[model samples]
Every structure is written in structure tokens, then in C-alpha cells.
Target: MKRIVAGGFFLLSGVLLYLGVHLAAAMYLPHITGWSTPPGKYGTALRETGGYAANLFSILLMIGGSLILLIELYFPHAAATYKKALAERNREYEKKHNLRE
Candidate 1:
């Protein structure tokens, strides 16, 4: 079950990351095509701002996907460690309260 979930996360993250890269490329397409020059200040500002926004979104998506993949891969061990720590803390709390069972 855990393997399946992790595999799904890996697949989803890979697709998201790929899409982000494609979107980023699209954000730069106009510049690469030598047609980036705008007719007016407003046009230039709009174009630049739009491109930056798109690129920013793409970068965020890529980062989010990568983090998801990493988390999915490491979650099992992390969860186990957290559970152990929680149990230890609970035990300490109970001891302090003189409520051992």
C-alpha cells in the first residue's frame, strides 16, 4: 500500500515537474523568437510582468512537485520516527504525572 502510494506520488510529481518546465520554456518563447520588443511602455511592462508571473508559477510548481516526491519517499521512516518520539514523550508525561499504566 505504501509502495503504491509512493509510486503514485512519484508519477504525479514527475508529470507536474515536466509541465512546469514546459511552462517556463513557454514564458521565454517570445524572447527566443526575437519578437519580444513591445510597441509601448505599457505593452512592454505587461509582457514582462506576465512572463515573470508565469515563470514564477512554473518554478513554484516544480519546487512543490519535487518536495512532494521527496516527502513521499521519506515519509515512512519519518512517520515511524515521529511515532516513536511521541510514544516516548507520552511515557515521560505519564511518569511525571504518576499515572503510569
Candidate 2:
């Protein structure tokens, strides 16, 4: 069950990261054209501003998604570390209480 949940998190993180990358690429297309404005033929000032806003949002999405993915990937190691610490604590408690098996 835990494995399944972790797998789901991994899948979701991968999907979000993939989408963020694609969106960032799309947002870059306008800058690459040397147009210095929005890419539409009927582009207006408002449209240009909106385009810039969308690009900013995409960048934010990319950063956030990558961070989340990094956390998801590191979760297992974190869990292991926590478990090791807990076991060590338990051993210390047993030794203090003279309850060692």
C-alpha cells in the first residue's frame, strides 16, 4: 500500500514536471521569434501582457514541480533515515531499562 502511494506520487510528479517543461518550451517560442511581442497575428498590448504573465506562471510551475519531484524522489531515503533513527532510539531505551533481549 505504501509502495502504491509512493508510485502514485512518483507518477504525478513526473507528469507535472513534464507538463512544466513543455509549457516553459512553449513560453520560450515567442522570445525566439525576435518579434518582441506576443506571437499572435492579432496581438494587442493586453495580449502581450497576458503572454508575459503566462510565461511567468509557467516558470513558477516548472520550479514548483521540479521541487516537488525532488522531494518525492527523496522521500524513501528520508523514510529510511527516520526508521533508522527510531530504531536507534528504541535500542537506547531498551538498554536504559535493562530490557535487552
Local accuracy of candidate 2 as per-residue lDDT tens digits, 36-81 = 4444432432244345555456556556655665676788789999
Residue pairs whose backbone atoms clash in candidate 2: none
RMSD for each model, in Å, please? 6.9, 7.2
Q: Show where candidate 1 strays beyond 4 Å.
A: 1-34, 38-65
Model 2 regions more than 4 Å off: 1-49, 99-101
The Cα local distance difference test for each model comes to: 0.62, 0.60
Residue pairs with backbone overlap in model 1: none
Tens-digit lDDT track for model 1 on 1-101? Answer: 57556556655665665566556555655654333445344344335445545545646655665666667678978999999999999999999999976
TM-score of every model versus the real structure: 0.39, 0.47
Query: Which stretch of 10 consecutive residues in model 1 shows the poorest summed lDDT?
Result: 33-42
